[model samples]
Target: MAEESTKSWADTDSESSSSSSSSSDSEQEEVHYLIDDQTSDDEVFDFSNIEFTREDLVQALNDMVHEYKTLSHTFEEIKAENASLKNSSAKSSSDELEDTDSLKIELSKLRIENELLRSESSELKAEVEKLTK
Candidate 1:
Protein backbone atom coordinates (compact mmCIF):
# COMPACT_ATOMS: atom_id res chain seq x y z
CA MET A 1 0.00 0.00 0.00
CA ALA A 2 2.85 2.37 0.89
CA GLU A 3 4.55 1.48 -2.36
CA GLU A 4 1.36 2.20 -4.27
CA SER A 5 1.01 5.56 -2.56
CA THR A 6 4.63 6.41 -3.41
CA LYS A 7 4.10 5.29 -7.01
CA SER A 8 0.99 7.51 -7.31
CA TRP A 9 2.92 10.51 -5.93
CA ALA A 10 5.78 9.83 -8.34
CA ASP A 11 3.42 9.56 -11.34
CA THR A 12 1.74 12.82 -10.40
CA ASP A 13 5.08 14.70 -10.57
CA SER A 14 6.51 12.75 -13.56
CA GLU A 15 5.03 15.04 -16.27
CA SER A 16 4.59 18.32 -14.41
CA SER A 17 4.83 20.43 -17.60
CA SER A 18 2.12 18.35 -19.37
CA SER A 19 -0.09 18.54 -16.27
CA SER A 20 0.32 22.35 -16.12
CA SER A 21 -0.53 22.64 -19.86
CA SER A 22 -3.65 20.53 -19.39
CA SER A 23 -4.64 22.65 -16.34
CA SER A 24 -4.22 25.83 -18.38
CA ASP A 25 -6.37 24.40 -21.19
CA SER A 26 -9.04 23.45 -18.69
CA GLU A 27 -8.95 27.02 -17.18
CA GLN A 28 -9.60 28.39 -20.70
CA GLU A 29 -12.69 26.10 -20.96
CA GLU A 30 -14.54 28.54 -18.60
CA VAL A 31 -16.12 27.05 -15.46
CA HIS A 32 -18.63 28.66 -13.09
CA TYR A 33 -17.77 29.53 -9.44
CA LEU A 34 -19.93 30.90 -6.55
CA ILE A 35 -19.41 33.51 -3.83
CA ASP A 36 -21.60 33.95 -0.70
CA ASP A 37 -24.36 31.73 -2.32
CA GLN A 38 -24.41 34.19 -5.26
CA THR A 39 -22.87 33.59 -8.68
CA SER A 40 -20.04 36.09 -9.42
CA ASP A 41 -19.25 36.08 -13.17
CA ASP A 42 -16.46 38.64 -12.73
CA GLU A 43 -13.67 38.12 -10.20
CA VAL A 44 -13.62 41.54 -8.64
CA PHE A 45 -10.45 41.03 -6.55
CA ASP A 46 -10.31 44.37 -4.66
CA PHE A 47 -7.37 45.52 -2.44
CA SER A 48 -9.02 48.59 -0.76
CA ASN A 49 -9.95 46.73 2.47
CA ILE A 50 -6.55 47.61 4.04
CA GLU A 51 -6.65 50.59 6.43
CA PHE A 52 -3.32 52.41 6.15
CA THR A 53 -2.46 54.45 3.08
CA ARG A 54 1.02 55.34 1.83
CA GLU A 55 0.45 58.96 2.84
CA ASP A 56 -0.70 57.95 6.33
CA LEU A 57 2.33 55.72 6.84
CA VAL A 58 4.68 58.44 5.60
CA GLN A 59 3.11 61.00 7.97
CA ALA A 60 3.46 58.66 10.94
CA LEU A 61 7.13 58.02 10.13
CA ASN A 62 7.78 61.78 9.84
CA ASP A 63 6.14 62.39 13.23
CA MET A 64 8.28 59.69 14.82
CA VAL A 65 11.42 61.22 13.24
CA HIS A 66 10.56 64.65 14.66
CA GLU A 67 10.00 63.17 18.14
CA TYR A 68 13.36 61.38 17.99
CA LYS A 69 15.11 64.59 16.97
CA THR A 70 13.52 66.53 19.85
CA LEU A 71 14.55 63.81 22.33
CA SER A 72 18.15 63.93 21.04
CA HIS A 73 18.24 67.71 21.46
CA THR A 74 16.94 67.41 25.01
CA PHE A 75 19.59 64.78 25.80
CA GLU A 76 22.32 67.07 24.48
CA GLU A 77 21.03 69.92 26.65
CA ILE A 78 21.07 67.75 29.78
CA LYS A 79 24.59 66.57 29.03
CA ALA A 80 25.84 70.15 28.60
CA GLU A 81 24.27 71.17 31.88
CA ASN A 82 25.86 68.23 33.68
CA ALA A 83 29.29 69.05 32.28
CA SER A 84 29.00 72.72 33.34
CA LEU A 85 28.06 71.70 36.85
CA LYS A 86 30.99 69.33 37.12
CA ASN A 87 33.42 71.99 35.91
CA SER A 88 32.06 74.54 38.40
CA SER A 89 32.36 72.02 41.24
CA ALA A 90 35.99 71.34 40.38
CA LYS A 91 36.78 75.09 40.26
CA SER A 92 35.18 75.72 43.65
CA SER A 93 37.05 72.82 45.24
CA SER A 94 40.37 74.17 43.94
CA ASP A 95 39.53 77.62 45.31
CA GLU A 96 38.83 76.09 48.70
CA LEU A 97 42.19 74.31 48.63
CA GLU A 98 44.00 77.59 47.88
CA ASP A 99 42.26 79.30 50.80
CA THR A 100 43.25 76.46 53.14
CA ASP A 101 46.90 76.76 52.00
CA SER A 102 46.89 80.50 52.73
CA LEU A 103 45.48 79.92 56.24
CA LYS A 104 48.17 77.35 57.03
CA ILE A 105 50.95 79.77 56.02
CA GLU A 106 49.48 82.49 58.26
CA LEU A 107 49.28 80.07 61.22
CA SER A 108 52.95 79.11 60.71
CA LYS A 109 54.01 82.80 60.83
CA LEU A 110 52.08 83.36 64.07
CA ARG A 111 53.78 80.37 65.73
CA ILE A 112 57.26 81.74 64.89
CA GLU A 113 56.32 85.15 66.36
CA ASN A 114 55.05 83.44 69.57
CA GLU A 115 58.37 81.61 70.00
CA LEU A 116 60.37 84.87 69.60
CA LEU A 117 58.24 86.57 72.27
CA ARG A 118 58.87 83.72 74.76
CA SER A 119 62.67 83.93 74.27
CA GLU A 120 62.60 87.73 74.87
CA SER A 121 60.59 87.29 78.06
CA SER A 122 63.09 84.73 79.45
CA GLU A 123 66.05 87.08 78.81
CA LEU A 124 64.26 89.99 80.58
CA LYS A 125 63.57 87.79 83.67
CA ALA A 126 67.28 86.84 83.94
CA GLU A 127 68.33 90.51 83.77
CA VAL A 128 65.84 91.50 86.54
CA GLU A 129 67.16 88.76 88.83
CA LYS A 130 70.77 89.99 88.37
CA LEU A 131 69.68 93.56 89.12
CA THR A 132 67.92 92.40 92.35
CA LYS A 133 71.07 90.61 93.58
Candidate 2:
Protein backbone atom coordinates (compact mmCIF):
# COMPACT_ATOMS: atom_id res chain seq x y z
CA MET A 1 0.00 0.00 0.00
CA ALA A 2 2.82 2.33 0.77
CA GLU A 3 4.44 1.62 -2.59
CA GLU A 4 1.17 2.31 -4.39
CA SER A 5 0.79 5.62 -2.53
CA THR A 6 4.26 6.70 -3.51
CA LYS A 7 3.58 5.98 -7.16
CA SER A 8 0.34 8.00 -7.05
CA TRP A 9 2.09 10.99 -5.51
CA ALA A 10 4.81 10.86 -8.12
CA ASP A 11 2.24 10.87 -10.92
CA THR A 12 0.47 13.90 -9.44
CA ASP A 13 3.68 15.83 -9.15
CA SER A 14 4.59 15.17 -12.77
CA GLU A 15 1.11 16.16 -13.94
CA SER A 16 1.19 19.43 -12.02
CA SER A 17 4.60 20.36 -13.41
CA SER A 18 3.50 19.65 -16.99
CA SER A 19 0.33 21.73 -16.59
CA SER A 20 2.27 24.63 -15.11
CA SER A 21 4.77 24.54 -17.98
CA SER A 22 1.95 24.58 -20.57
CA SER A 23 0.35 27.57 -18.86
CA SER A 24 3.64 29.43 -18.82
CA ASP A 25 4.09 28.73 -22.53
CA SER A 26 0.60 30.07 -23.29
CA GLU A 27 1.30 33.24 -21.28
CA GLN A 28 4.47 33.86 -23.26
CA GLU A 29 2.56 33.48 -26.53
CA GLU A 30 -0.03 36.03 -25.40
CA VAL A 31 2.68 38.51 -24.48
CA HIS A 32 4.35 38.10 -27.83
CA TYR A 33 1.07 38.70 -29.70
CA LEU A 34 0.40 41.81 -27.72
CA ILE A 35 3.85 43.19 -28.51
CA ASP A 36 3.47 42.43 -32.25
CA ASP A 37 0.12 44.24 -32.53
CA GLN A 38 0.33 47.82 -33.76
CA THR A 39 -1.96 50.35 -32.13
CA SER A 40 -3.01 53.86 -33.06
CA ASP A 41 -1.59 56.91 -31.32
CA ASP A 42 -4.84 57.56 -29.43
CA GLU A 43 -4.84 54.09 -27.87
CA VAL A 44 -3.49 53.66 -24.35
CA PHE A 45 -1.55 50.68 -23.04
CA ASP A 46 -3.36 48.43 -20.56
CA PHE A 47 -1.06 46.87 -17.95
CA SER A 48 -3.61 45.78 -15.37
CA ASN A 49 -3.63 42.13 -16.42
CA ILE A 50 0.17 41.75 -16.32
CA GLU A 51 1.76 40.78 -12.98
CA PHE A 52 5.10 42.18 -11.76
CA THR A 53 6.94 42.40 -8.48
CA ARG A 54 8.22 45.71 -7.09
CA GLU A 55 11.79 44.67 -7.72
CA ASP A 56 11.02 43.95 -11.37
CA LEU A 57 9.54 47.40 -11.86
CA VAL A 58 12.48 49.09 -10.20
CA GLN A 59 14.99 47.19 -12.29
CA ALA A 60 13.13 48.13 -15.52
CA LEU A 61 13.14 51.83 -14.54
CA ASN A 62 16.83 51.77 -13.80
CA ASP A 63 17.57 50.19 -17.13
CA MET A 64 15.63 52.94 -18.91
CA VAL A 65 17.52 55.67 -17.06
CA HIS A 66 20.83 54.14 -18.00
CA GLU A 67 19.81 54.00 -21.64
CA TYR A 68 18.72 57.64 -21.59
CA LYS A 69 22.04 58.76 -20.16
CA THR A 70 23.97 56.84 -22.82
CA LEU A 71 21.89 58.38 -25.62
CA SER A 72 22.35 61.87 -24.17
CA HIS A 73 26.10 61.50 -24.17
CA THR A 74 26.05 60.31 -27.81
CA PHE A 75 23.91 63.31 -28.82
CA GLU A 76 26.37 65.75 -27.24
CA GLU A 77 29.27 64.14 -29.06
CA ILE A 78 27.46 64.46 -32.41
CA LYS A 79 26.73 68.14 -31.76
CA ALA A 80 30.38 68.84 -31.06
CA GLU A 81 31.49 67.08 -34.26
CA ASN A 82 28.94 69.07 -36.31
CA ALA A 83 30.15 72.35 -34.89
CA SER A 84 33.75 71.51 -35.68
CA LEU A 85 32.89 70.65 -39.28
CA LYS A 86 30.98 73.92 -39.68
CA ASN A 87 33.90 75.96 -38.39
CA SER A 88 36.31 74.23 -40.73
CA SER A 89 33.98 74.78 -43.70
CA ALA A 90 33.66 78.48 -42.86
CA LYS A 91 37.42 78.94 -42.62
CA SER A 92 37.98 77.19 -45.97
CA SER A 93 35.35 79.46 -47.60
CA SER A 94 37.01 82.59 -46.22
CA ASP A 95 40.40 81.52 -47.55
CA GLU A 96 38.96 80.87 -51.03
CA LEU A 97 37.40 84.34 -51.11
CA GLU A 98 40.65 85.99 -50.16
CA ASP A 99 42.53 84.11 -52.90
CA THR A 100 39.91 85.16 -55.48
CA ASP A 101 40.24 88.82 -54.48
CA SER A 102 44.01 88.68 -54.81
CA LEU A 103 43.74 87.14 -58.29
CA LYS A 104 41.39 89.93 -59.41
CA ILE A 105 43.83 92.61 -58.23
CA GLU A 106 46.72 90.95 -60.11
CA LEU A 107 44.66 90.78 -63.33
CA SER A 108 43.81 94.49 -63.11
CA LYS A 109 47.45 95.44 -62.64
CA LEU A 110 48.48 93.34 -65.68
CA ARG A 111 45.83 95.09 -67.82
CA ILE A 112 47.18 98.56 -66.86
CA GLU A 113 50.77 97.53 -67.74
CA ASN A 114 49.64 96.18 -71.12
CA GLU A 115 48.02 99.53 -72.03
CA LEU A 116 51.16 101.46 -71.11
CA LEU A 117 53.35 99.17 -73.26
CA ARG A 118 51.04 99.59 -76.29
CA SER A 119 51.19 103.40 -76.03
CA GLU A 120 55.01 103.36 -75.95
CA SER A 121 55.18 101.07 -78.99
CA SER A 122 52.92 103.44 -80.97
CA GLU A 123 55.15 106.44 -80.16
CA LEU A 124 58.27 104.60 -81.33
CA LYS A 125 56.56 103.57 -84.55
CA ALA A 126 55.65 107.20 -85.39
CA GLU A 127 59.25 108.40 -84.85
CA VAL A 128 60.60 105.66 -87.12
CA GLU A 129 58.18 106.66 -89.92
CA LYS A 130 59.25 110.33 -89.72
CA LEU A 131 62.95 109.52 -89.94
CA THR A 132 62.49 107.21 -92.89
CA LYS A 133 60.52 109.83 -94.83
Candidate 3:
Protein backbone atom coordinates (compact mmCIF):
# COMPACT_ATOMS: atom_id res chain seq x y z
CA MET A 1 0.00 0.00 0.00
CA ALA A 2 2.81 2.35 0.87
CA GLU A 3 4.62 1.63 -2.34
CA GLU A 4 1.46 2.18 -4.34
CA SER A 5 0.83 5.51 -2.59
CA THR A 6 4.43 6.64 -3.24
CA LYS A 7 4.13 5.63 -6.87
CA SER A 8 0.89 7.57 -7.22
CA TRP A 9 2.46 10.67 -5.67
CA ALA A 10 5.47 10.42 -7.96
CA ASP A 11 3.27 10.06 -10.98
CA THR A 12 1.24 13.11 -10.01
CA ASP A 13 4.39 15.13 -9.32
CA SER A 14 5.84 14.29 -12.71
CA GLU A 15 2.67 15.23 -14.52
CA SER A 16 2.46 18.56 -12.68
CA SER A 17 6.08 19.42 -13.42
CA SER A 18 5.71 18.62 -17.09
CA SER A 19 2.55 20.63 -17.47
CA SER A 20 3.91 23.58 -15.45
CA SER A 21 7.04 23.72 -17.56
CA SER A 22 4.97 23.94 -20.70
CA SER A 23 2.40 26.48 -19.40
CA SER A 24 2.45 30.17 -18.49
CA ASP A 25 2.13 31.55 -14.93
CA SER A 26 -1.64 32.04 -15.25
CA GLU A 27 -2.14 28.48 -16.38
CA GLN A 28 0.05 27.20 -13.54
CA GLU A 29 -1.98 29.21 -11.03
CA GLU A 30 -5.17 27.57 -12.31
CA VAL A 31 -3.66 24.09 -11.87
CA HIS A 32 -2.58 24.70 -8.26
CA TYR A 33 -4.94 24.09 -5.34
CA LEU A 34 -5.23 25.12 -1.69
CA ILE A 35 -5.78 22.60 1.09
CA ASP A 36 -7.26 23.26 4.49
CA ASP A 37 -6.26 22.05 7.95
CA GLN A 38 -8.79 19.24 7.71
CA THR A 39 -6.99 17.82 4.68
CA SER A 40 -5.72 14.28 5.19
CA ASP A 41 -1.97 13.65 5.61
CA ASP A 42 -1.91 11.72 2.35
CA GLU A 43 -3.52 14.64 0.51
CA VAL A 44 -0.87 17.16 1.55
CA PHE A 45 1.87 17.91 -0.99
CA ASP A 46 5.38 19.12 -0.22
CA PHE A 47 6.79 22.24 -1.92
CA SER A 48 10.25 20.71 -2.29
CA ASN A 49 10.52 21.35 -6.04
CA ILE A 50 9.82 25.09 -5.73
CA GLU A 51 13.04 27.10 -6.06
CA PHE A 52 13.69 30.78 -5.24
CA THR A 53 16.59 32.71 -6.69
CA ARG A 54 18.69 35.07 -4.59
CA GLU A 55 16.93 38.13 -6.06
CA ASP A 56 13.53 36.63 -5.33
CA LEU A 57 14.45 35.96 -1.72
CA VAL A 58 15.96 39.39 -1.25
CA GLN A 59 12.93 41.14 -2.70
CA ALA A 60 10.60 39.10 -0.48
CA LEU A 61 12.65 39.94 2.62
CA ASN A 62 12.70 43.62 1.76
CA ASP A 63 8.94 43.64 1.21
CA MET A 64 8.40 41.98 4.59
CA VAL A 65 10.67 44.50 6.31
CA HIS A 66 8.82 47.40 4.76
CA GLU A 67 5.49 45.95 5.90
CA TYR A 68 6.81 45.46 9.42
CA LYS A 69 8.04 49.05 9.58
CA THR A 70 4.70 50.35 8.37
CA LEU A 71 2.77 48.35 10.98
CA SER A 72 5.14 49.47 13.75
CA HIS A 73 4.69 53.11 12.80
CA THR A 74 0.91 52.70 12.86
CA PHE A 75 1.07 51.05 16.27
CA GLU A 76 3.12 53.94 17.66
CA GLU A 77 0.65 56.44 16.27
CA ILE A 78 -2.26 54.63 17.94
CA LYS A 79 -0.38 54.51 21.24
CA ALA A 80 0.26 58.22 21.05
CA GLU A 81 -3.38 58.90 20.28
CA ASN A 82 -4.48 56.77 23.23
CA ALA A 83 -2.13 58.68 25.54
CA SER A 84 -3.41 62.01 24.26
CA LEU A 85 -7.02 60.93 24.87
CA LYS A 86 -6.22 59.90 28.42
CA ASN A 87 -4.52 63.20 29.14
CA SER A 88 -7.45 65.13 27.77
CA SER A 89 -9.87 63.05 29.86
CA ALA A 90 -7.83 63.77 33.01
CA LYS A 91 -7.71 67.47 32.23
CA SER A 92 -11.48 67.55 31.72
CA SER A 93 -12.08 65.84 35.05
CA SER A 94 -9.84 68.34 36.83
CA ASP A 95 -11.61 71.22 35.14
CA GLU A 96 -14.99 69.86 36.30
CA LEU A 97 -13.76 69.60 39.86
CA GLU A 98 -12.52 73.18 39.79
CA ASP A 99 -15.87 74.35 38.44
CA THR A 100 -17.72 72.54 41.23
CA ASP A 101 -15.49 74.15 43.88
CA SER A 102 -16.07 77.60 42.42
CA LEU A 103 -19.83 77.04 42.37
CA LYS A 104 -19.78 75.99 46.04
CA ILE A 105 -17.87 79.14 46.98
CA GLU A 106 -20.37 81.31 45.13
CA LEU A 107 -23.30 79.56 46.84
CA SER A 108 -21.76 80.22 50.25
CA LYS A 109 -21.39 83.92 49.43
CA LEU A 110 -25.01 84.12 48.24
CA ARG A 111 -26.24 82.52 51.47
CA ILE A 112 -24.33 85.04 53.56
CA GLU A 113 -25.77 87.91 51.53
CA ASN A 114 -29.26 86.49 51.96
CA GLU A 115 -28.87 86.34 55.74
CA LEU A 116 -27.67 89.97 55.83
CA LEU A 117 -30.69 91.06 53.79
CA ARG A 118 -33.04 89.28 56.21
CA SER A 119 -31.48 90.99 59.18
CA GLU A 120 -31.82 94.40 57.57
CA SER A 121 -35.47 93.75 56.73
CA SER A 122 -36.17 92.75 60.33
CA GLU A 123 -34.51 95.94 61.63
CA LEU A 124 -36.59 98.07 59.24
CA LYS A 125 -39.82 96.40 60.37
CA ALA A 126 -39.00 97.12 64.07
CA GLU A 127 -38.37 100.79 63.32
CA VAL A 128 -41.67 101.02 61.46
CA GLU A 129 -43.51 99.62 64.55
CA LYS A 130 -41.81 102.16 66.85
CA LEU A 131 -42.73 105.02 64.53
CA THR A 132 -46.38 103.85 64.42
CA LYS A 133 -46.58 103.57 68.21
Candidate 4:
Protein backbone atom coordinates (compact mmCIF):
# COMPACT_ATOMS: atom_id res chain seq x y z
CA MET A 1 0.00 0.00 0.00
CA ALA A 2 2.82 2.45 0.88
CA GLU A 3 4.66 1.77 -2.41
CA GLU A 4 1.46 2.31 -4.39
CA SER A 5 0.82 5.62 -2.63
CA THR A 6 4.38 6.84 -3.36
CA LYS A 7 4.08 5.80 -7.01
CA SER A 8 0.77 7.66 -7.42
CA TRP A 9 2.29 10.81 -5.84
CA ALA A 10 5.26 10.69 -8.23
CA ASP A 11 2.93 10.21 -11.21
CA THR A 12 0.82 13.19 -10.15
CA ASP A 13 3.94 15.37 -9.76
CA SER A 14 5.21 14.46 -13.25
CA GLU A 15 1.77 15.07 -14.81
CA SER A 16 1.46 18.51 -13.18
CA SER A 17 4.97 19.55 -14.34
CA SER A 18 4.22 18.45 -17.93
CA SER A 19 0.88 20.27 -17.96
CA SER A 20 2.50 23.47 -16.61
CA SER A 21 5.21 23.40 -19.33
CA SER A 22 2.58 22.87 -22.03
CA SER A 23 0.47 25.75 -20.76
CA SER A 24 3.53 28.07 -20.74
CA ASP A 25 4.30 27.15 -24.33
CA SER A 26 0.71 27.90 -25.39
CA GLU A 27 0.80 31.27 -23.54
CA GLN A 28 3.99 32.28 -25.43
CA GLU A 29 2.33 31.51 -28.75
CA GLU A 30 -0.76 33.54 -27.76
CA VAL A 31 1.44 36.54 -26.82
CA HIS A 32 3.20 36.42 -30.21
CA TYR A 33 -0.16 36.32 -32.04
CA LEU A 34 -1.51 39.22 -30.00
CA ILE A 35 1.57 41.32 -30.81
CA ASP A 36 1.14 40.66 -34.55
CA ASP A 37 -2.60 41.46 -34.38
CA GLN A 38 -1.96 44.77 -32.56
CA THR A 39 0.57 45.94 -35.17
CA SER A 40 -1.85 45.05 -37.99
CA ASP A 41 -4.73 46.88 -36.21
CA ASP A 42 -2.62 50.01 -35.59
CA GLU A 43 -1.97 50.39 -39.34
CA VAL A 44 -5.71 50.25 -40.13
CA PHE A 45 -6.90 53.30 -38.11
CA ASP A 46 -5.92 56.43 -40.12
CA PHE A 47 -6.39 59.33 -37.67
CA SER A 48 -5.72 61.91 -40.41
CA ASN A 49 -9.29 61.52 -41.74
CA ILE A 50 -10.93 62.33 -38.38
CA GLU A 51 -12.27 65.90 -37.69
CA PHE A 52 -13.66 67.63 -34.53
CA THR A 53 -16.06 70.60 -34.80
CA ARG A 54 -16.86 73.38 -32.28
CA GLU A 55 -20.37 72.07 -31.72
CA ASP A 56 -19.03 68.67 -30.74
CA LEU A 57 -16.73 70.28 -28.17
CA VAL A 58 -19.59 72.35 -26.68
CA GLN A 59 -21.90 69.30 -26.46
CA ALA A 60 -19.23 67.25 -24.69
CA LEU A 61 -18.57 70.03 -22.20
CA ASN A 62 -22.30 70.39 -21.46
CA ASP A 63 -22.60 66.64 -20.84
CA MET A 64 -19.66 66.73 -18.42
CA VAL A 65 -21.19 69.68 -16.48
CA HIS A 66 -24.56 67.90 -16.18
CA GLU A 67 -22.91 64.73 -14.91
CA TYR A 68 -20.89 66.72 -12.36
CA LYS A 69 -24.03 68.43 -11.00
CA THR A 70 -25.80 65.08 -10.59
CA LEU A 71 -22.79 63.60 -8.82
CA SER A 72 -22.48 66.60 -6.48
CA HIS A 73 -26.16 66.35 -5.50
CA THR A 74 -25.75 62.65 -4.74
CA PHE A 75 -22.63 63.35 -2.66
CA GLU A 76 -24.50 65.96 -0.57
CA GLU A 77 -27.37 63.56 0.08
CA ILE A 78 -24.92 60.86 1.24
CA LYS A 79 -23.21 63.35 3.53
CA ALA A 80 -26.53 64.35 5.11
CA GLU A 81 -27.43 60.69 5.64
CA ASN A 82 -24.02 60.07 7.22
CA ALA A 83 -24.52 62.96 9.62
CA SER A 84 -27.98 61.69 10.60
CA LEU A 85 -26.59 58.23 11.34
CA LYS A 86 -23.80 59.69 13.48
CA ASN A 87 -26.33 61.69 15.52
CA SER A 88 -28.44 58.59 16.16
CA SER A 89 -25.35 56.63 17.17
CA ALA A 90 -24.38 59.31 19.64
CA LYS A 91 -27.88 59.27 21.18
CA SER A 92 -27.81 55.48 21.55
CA SER A 93 -24.36 55.59 23.12
CA SER A 94 -25.55 58.05 25.75
CA ASP A 95 -28.56 55.86 26.49
CA GLU A 96 -26.29 52.85 26.87
CA LEU A 97 -24.09 54.73 29.32
CA GLU A 98 -27.15 55.63 31.42
CA ASP A 99 -28.27 51.99 31.40
CA THR A 100 -24.80 50.86 32.53
CA ASP A 101 -24.84 53.35 35.40
CA SER A 102 -28.29 52.17 36.54
CA LEU A 103 -27.16 48.53 36.47
CA LYS A 104 -24.12 49.33 38.60
CA ILE A 105 -26.31 51.08 41.18
CA GLU A 106 -28.68 48.06 41.29
CA LEU A 107 -25.74 45.71 41.84
CA SER A 108 -24.44 47.75 44.78
CA LYS A 109 -27.90 47.75 46.37
CA LEU A 110 -28.20 43.98 46.02
CA ARG A 111 -24.79 43.47 47.65
CA ILE A 112 -25.81 45.50 50.65
CA GLU A 113 -29.10 43.60 50.98
CA ASN A 114 -27.25 40.29 50.83
CA GLU A 115 -24.89 41.31 53.63
CA LEU A 116 -27.85 42.37 55.81
CA LEU A 117 -29.59 39.02 55.24
CA ARG A 118 -26.43 37.13 56.20
CA SER A 119 -26.05 39.07 59.45
CA GLU A 120 -29.74 38.52 60.40
CA SER A 121 -29.39 34.78 59.69
CA SER A 122 -26.37 34.54 62.04
CA GLU A 123 -28.31 36.36 64.81
CA LEU A 124 -31.24 33.93 64.50
CA LYS A 125 -28.88 30.98 64.72
CA ALA A 126 -27.35 32.37 67.94
CA GLU A 127 -30.83 32.85 69.48
CA VAL A 128 -31.75 29.22 68.65
CA GLU A 129 -28.55 27.99 70.35
CA LYS A 130 -29.33 30.04 73.45
CA LEU A 131 -32.87 28.65 73.62
CA THR A 132 -31.56 25.07 73.49
CA LYS A 133 -29.16 25.80 76.36
Write candidate 3's Cα lDDT for 1-133 as tens digits.
3455556667966787776554656655554543233356654234223663434445555677799999999999999999999999999999999999999999999999999999999999999999999
lDDT string, candidate 2, 15-133, tens digits: 76777777878877897687657464633433334665444445555677799999999999999999999999999999999999999999999999999999999999999999999
Model 3 stretches with alpha carbons more than 4 Å out: 1-58
Tell how far residue 108 is off in model 1, in angstroms: 1.0
lDDT by residue for model 1 (1-133), tens: 3455556556855765566777866654443222333434543331232663444545555677799999999999999999999999999999999999999999999999999999999999999999999
Q: Give each model a TM-score.
A: 0.53, 0.56, 0.55, 0.59
Per-residue error (Å), model 1, residue 55: 2.7
Model 3 sits at a Cα RMSD from the real structure of: 12.3
Q: What is candidate 4's lDDT per residue for 4-85, written digit by digit as tens?
A: 5556667966776777777878876886676566655554333222464434445555677799999999999999999999
On a 0 to 100 scale, what is the lDDT of residue 66 in model 3? 90
Give candidate 4 regions above 4 Å deviation. Answer: 1-50
Q: Which TM-score value belongs to model 2?
A: 0.56
Q: Which wins on TM-score, candidate 1 or candidate 4?
A: 4
Q: Candidates ranked by TM-score, best first?
A: 4, 2, 3, 1
Return the clash pairs for model 1, or none.
none
- Comparing 1 and 2 on TM-score, the stronger one: 2
- Please list the C-alpha lDDT of all candidates, in the order they appear: 0.70, 0.76, 0.73, 0.76
